[model samples]
Target chain A: MAHRWKNDLTRADATPYAAFMNRRQLMGGALGLGLIGAAGAARAAEELVPNSWEDITQYNNYYEFGTRKDDPARNAHTLTTSPWTVKIDGLVDNPGDYSMAQILDAMTIEERIYRFRCVEAWSMVIPWNGFELADLLTMAGVQDGAKYVAFETALRPDEMPGVSYPVLDWPYVEGLRLDEAMHPLTMMATGIYGKTIPNQNGAPMRLVVPWKYGFKSIKSIVRITLTEDEPPTSWNKANAREYGFYSNVNPEVDHPRWSQASERLVGGGLFARRQPTLMFNGYADEVASLYEGMDLSKFI
Target chain B: MSIADRINPLARKLPTWVVYVLYLLPVPVLLYMAQTGGLGREPVKALEHELGEIAIQLLIIGLCISPLRRFAGVNLLKFRRAFGILAFVYVVLHLLVWAVLDVQTLERVWADIVKRPYITVGMGAFVLMLPLIATSNNRAVRWLGPLWRQVHLLTYPVVLLAAVHFIWVRKGFQIEPILYLAVIGGLLALRLIPKRARVAA
Candidate 1:
């Protein structure tokens, strides 16, 4: 717990459910800690909220459900998260489809309050319950040659509408350098706020890499493939010029479409000033060393 | 009777200031929505987008007036000034919102205008419309005579640039923006038809 960075945002930062939903009649501010999946350990400044469960669950960029932000909340309920299985293959000594329950049973879970920065430049602070990704890689027995970790999200066309759009080649894929994958801060989140993650927010299991843009944290993952070579990521494949594989939150490196210098905080109210974006989304102190000599602008 | 004959009397019955207020109603509505948190998650961004879209839509509608009269026999001339002025005002407000609220950094706003192609094109459209906005009054129209009409013709290029700005600012293949471009292109194409051919048809 001492090593884990804590967010200072308390329950006060969260918008009440009624206000968040834009209901005309304001409701009493009831702190719904029901969503906190595990016992809370960190004390956070009231700078970031878990974005009110309604905001977290309702507004999402799960393209699997649809392209519009609200599409997932409306469409993802049909997804069967229970009885889910993840195929761990490639450079791991143990290669098989392990049930979600089996994987959770084998790991220790902790609550982590992390800033969720999107490549689109909006951000959120989420309280996630999960175990470090390193633990899972360790359990699977990473082979000596593995240099990168590739991940694939579920590709259920019958369930996920956006797959129909050629937004990207489907069975959405992402990867992290082996070192990045094994970073202590990188976790496989199972729940948010203190409850089982809602369907739209990638229920059952998802990846949370705070230092990188939100896209790098692939959601509703069904496959984890360790490899010796760099793996193709979804966005980088969609547009190489805009989305780089690393996708680290660097204010200096602008997205070709928009500036990465500042981000509008989700739930920050209409007139809330956009805060300056931090280098590596303020995790530069921890993760900057990982890309010590790499030319980020070129790589990006 | 022609639409111009019938509607001209009805339009004349309405006072100019009342028409102006009616034309400019969306400003207060947008401001109210912004204050009340009705603009959704990112309200400023939403407001900026809505205002910009409204400005472009009005610009397109303003461009459509002549073509509508020429091809369809619908005379909306009396309202064109209202449309153009409201569009210009909205564009100014949209730019201000981006600068004062969205960007909040003078240096960044300047950089965005200079460096970004979409912003550059958008700013170009606004600057092109400035003279048109300035000379919108009756006195300027009377003084400039035919030369005023020639300067107002800048609307064509401004529409094209604004439409291109709208298209360029979006990410990926968005159908709505392409549809907007198609509408603008259709209006511009209608203007290209010979006057006698349009009348005969």
Candidate 2:
């Protein structure tokens, strides 16, 4: 069945590639535009300015590499993403280790510009190139009684410095309900801005659930399991009080240590004011129905 | 000559204001880096963390003064006041950056301070420093006499709260913040040793 969902954001919405390469040029360009066309530039500024590829690739929360934001960028190069094999099992008809080449051959990839909101109250607009998660699940053949889908990240202690520290339970995990997993908005991202994703930004492949907080999008995926029981998540296991399993982006449901009502936009320079966080990270219109009967505050 | 005897004469010759100047040198450099993209993708956050870390470092250095004098025979006692004042200045800059550039709205700032435990703890540390900052001058020190030492004892709780704030602000049980807390706990524990025991040593 073809997905009915259409992308509200276009390529023009993305931060320019040239600008990503040199931010000084972008600033100078913005200043030049402001001088020439004040009203037009003001309107342009009002529109979403997706984070540069540098911002997305450099600042990451991939704890497998390390805890610090820049640690992944520095250390993740050692991870061997090539010849990767993902183990797909549990309640699926065709359960086996599918090679990355096979998966890419089987799926039809597309671009999705999404607003990524982190649980830490920071956000970025990312343009991802991937296939819908449903397509991959359908290919694997999800069996009956599979209520939930669990995902795991590759754990390599030698390659990943952060794993040795016990920053998070090794092999970080995340799960989503079967219905939510089948949603068209749920994606298996392979690249960013038409380039193969850098190791720091979850190389080879990663899950992208725009409606949920960024952590829910498990990176460097090694395993996918379709199960009846709700699987544990890394952040939730570390501190259940602060990080809920659902971990949906909800302004009303603040993290115990910090408020989620507003978020700082990355690559907006030092003086950029924090913008009010949107419910479902501005994808509520498409995904709000998925949680229709359930209470978000309780789940979060 | 003893190491202290050799170093103390030069230390005394160096004006105390040089300590203030040296400590404050990073403020402008950090601000400039933040403006020019040298602070990385999230300059605001990097700036905030850098400022807060510096403030905590200053507080830790302030805690080191008595220990350095007693255990190491280093007489940095005269520069202790500059460490406190500079730490307070960094804390103020950190708070201002969050309130003005980061939070932007007054209502949200107040709500965050009230609702968030980490922010509440951080703000509590900031509030406790007020009385200490007010009485840091020589006139107030002389006027309060022995009572001044009792009031300045607030440094223990302030440093503890600051460290706790750092730990609580982290997403997970990170070693960096925990190390800060451990160092602070150790420094404060050093005060428990009797002066007679120290003299005996």
Candidate 3:
């Protein structure tokens, strides 16, 4: 009755949820079916890095899901994830379309415990479920001219009420330097907390930029363009002072209007003392290499 | 006391029943949450925030009562006292949650206020609510006598403090808090204009 996956399960923290589903399947006599039937938590958890998916996605700065803390969770239930596809184009050799099913089939997902830092000054430890971007880029065959990789999420105003805001440029945009994109720590996340991606948290596909602020991670992606240019991202374009393209997690590069030194966990209650934000979000060992010899102060 | 013994029957009974009923609203909300097994995983904090926001919204409505009577012609009068008390209730609950669960000590609480500007503003706003709460009852109102008018003026300061609390509470000036401030500010300003000046001489 035990799940094939366990805590030794990897970054996406598929252990607990998968264990639950395996037990459920064993009891239902559908154990050998080998496919999920409402074992959603398992799929999301296993597929994503553990805790990588917000215990509540509403806390995410993706106002594209709606502004309130609980709005994204409440409203994101309407998305249809099965029909999803991500188009890989531009400087890539495999400049074509790929379905969600195909993308999953092509790569093995790993769980990475990433300390998520928001520009607003909050932090979370999330085990994300996704493979190295280098592996995916390797499949796509990045061209020599490719300096950055751009990501785009689907823009449907009907379901995503936040997209109606003039505050942002419709579809969410994010980019990574070629080296950052190719780093082992960078991932194309599809699920979290051992389940398929939640509709609100950018299901099917999203990117996890560990050392950067949460917004830099980008969610609900539809297109990935390997380009020679440094892409103008949505947040940076909206407020240059608040959101920089590098968006590194550094206490020194304080958010223009607020201090970056400490953060409070939303839903962590008013009483939870704001904790000092760790430099590089505690991922300095893994990700600090990407920015070697570069001054984070100037870049940030 | 019998209805015949009441000095001002309508004044005495209507406000009393209204206050009692008003005080009862938050109970159902709290109960349903309790029945739902305490607002889920991070129940205390989430519930505290929800209750606090609802309370603030109610205060805004209460502040709107006179404007409602003048402009909308709604008999929202009976609800004003209730609104004020409920807003105070939520504010108190908001503080209690922080003081007990979050801070755990007065020293730590004071330190938090000093260390963080938002916390300082938030606690200061809560302190402002104390006098307004004490003066809400007829006994204290009668005891203070003419000073009652001046003491109740704390409402004006409380409103400003609440706005300031919310402004600094946000990482950046958020739209919702700003909207609340503008609306609330406009209403309070409307109260200061001389009423007779508007009428023809």
Candidate 4:
């Protein structure tokens, strides 16, 4: 069957055009400074590059590992990704633990380049390699009563230091409406840029819901429960006023502390001009129908 | 001689202009780091945070001046004005980075200051510092005399507002901002102690 969601974006389109121009200007300034080595200057001139894996891996908010952005990179190495098991239960015919090998063998994997927008008003273009989340749920044989799909992250207190502190309720959890979870765009990613996902970026497998805020794309997923009720999400539970359960990438809905009207492109360096945030993060055409006849502002 | 008596002679030898130079050093260093991508992926946010942190640190240090003299016998009164002015400068830079670099629109900036309680508190702190910064000079100090101390008393509210601003800006319950608030609160509390008891101790 032809996929309804066709990816018009190539790897070249990952970084926005303005960011490329900004990098070029920055390269010129760097050369004038004579601080950058010839090798550094050459690397800087490369256009159409997505944020390097370094940026994606190093700058993270994997609170299971720690709260600070760099903490995950430094601390996530302790996480055991190999021989992982995902518990699939709650309104499913096959309600049991599925091993990584079983899950991978039963699914088809593909690369999906997506715009990742954080609620903190920063964004990155991530090229994720994985399979549609629906495939996994189908494998679990989701029952008729399932209205929501809940996900839970692996909670190993011995491995994750951030759990020691009451940052948020441990074993970070997230959820999506069953329809949204089954959407073709919703992916269960196991790799990034053609490599095994780094521990810092949620090793083994993670959910990637591009249209929603990044937190909705929970990391290091260990459980999938199809339920009849809307499951509570970590951020929403932490502060419902700021983080709504829906959390669609809506520019109009301003986060109480900061403006969501615009976002700073992560790889665009320090001086890059802020770009206006897109409605549904530029995927309105595909996902807008899911929320028809509903007020997004209220849902958000 | 007491340790503070010995420290006082060394402290006296330390020039007031050195405070300005030392405190102002972070501005260029941070800009250079931002330019070179040393501040990680989100440099604008990092720069804003660093500047705000420095401003708060300076404000805390400025607050220590009186208590240090009254209790510790370590006089740093000469550098107090320098610390206050430098902190104001960083506060201005922090606002500029958010307004000019991060937000980048006048309407949005105004809207944020009005709508966001944290930004409003931050702006209130900035506004409260204006008079303190303006009068942080010898001529104004001479002209205003006793009234000058009363006017500068605004620092208490300014520091409280700044601490609240920091606490509110963070996404989750972070310990660092809370620690800053606690330290500031303790420093402010010290000012309430009886002067005779403080001197006697």
* Model 3 lDDT at residue A200: 71
| After superposition, candidate 2 runs with Cα above 4 Å error | A1-4, A12-48, B199-201
Candidate 1 to native Cα RMSD, angstroms: 7.4
Candidate 2 lDDT over B85-119, as tens digits, reads 99999999999988888887788899989988889
TM-score (C-alpha) between model 1 and the true structure: 0.85
Once fitted onto the true fold, the runs of candidate 1 whose alpha carbons sit more than 4 angstroms away are A1-50, B1-19, B196-201
Query: Tens digit of lDDT per residue, candidate 1, span B4-111?
Result: 788767766766577578758888998898787666566777789889999998998798778777656667788889889989989999999989888877888988
Error of 4 at A41 (Å): 32
Q: Candidate 3, which segments miss by more than 4 Å at Cα? A: A1-62, A89-102, A111-127, A193-195, A227-229, A250-278, A292-300, B1-12, B15-21, B24-41, B68-82, B102-121, B134-151, B164-179
Q: 1 or 4: which has the higher TM-score?
A: 4
TM-score of 4: 0.92
What would the per-residue lDDT of candidate 4 be over residues A102-174, giving only the tens digit for each residue? 9999888787778889999898888889999988898889899999999999999999988988878877999
Question: What is each predicted model's overall lDDT from 0 to 1?
Answer: 0.82, 0.88, 0.70, 0.88
Could you give candidate 2's per-residue lDDT for residues A196-229 as a string of tens digits? 9889988899999998999999999999999999
Q: What is the C-alpha lDDT profile of model 1 across A54-111, one tens digit per residue?
A: 6577668888888667789889998989899999999998999999989988987777
- TM values, all candidates: 0.85, 0.92, 0.72, 0.92
Per-chain TM-score, chain A, candidate 1: 0.85
Residue A206 in model 1: lDDT: 91
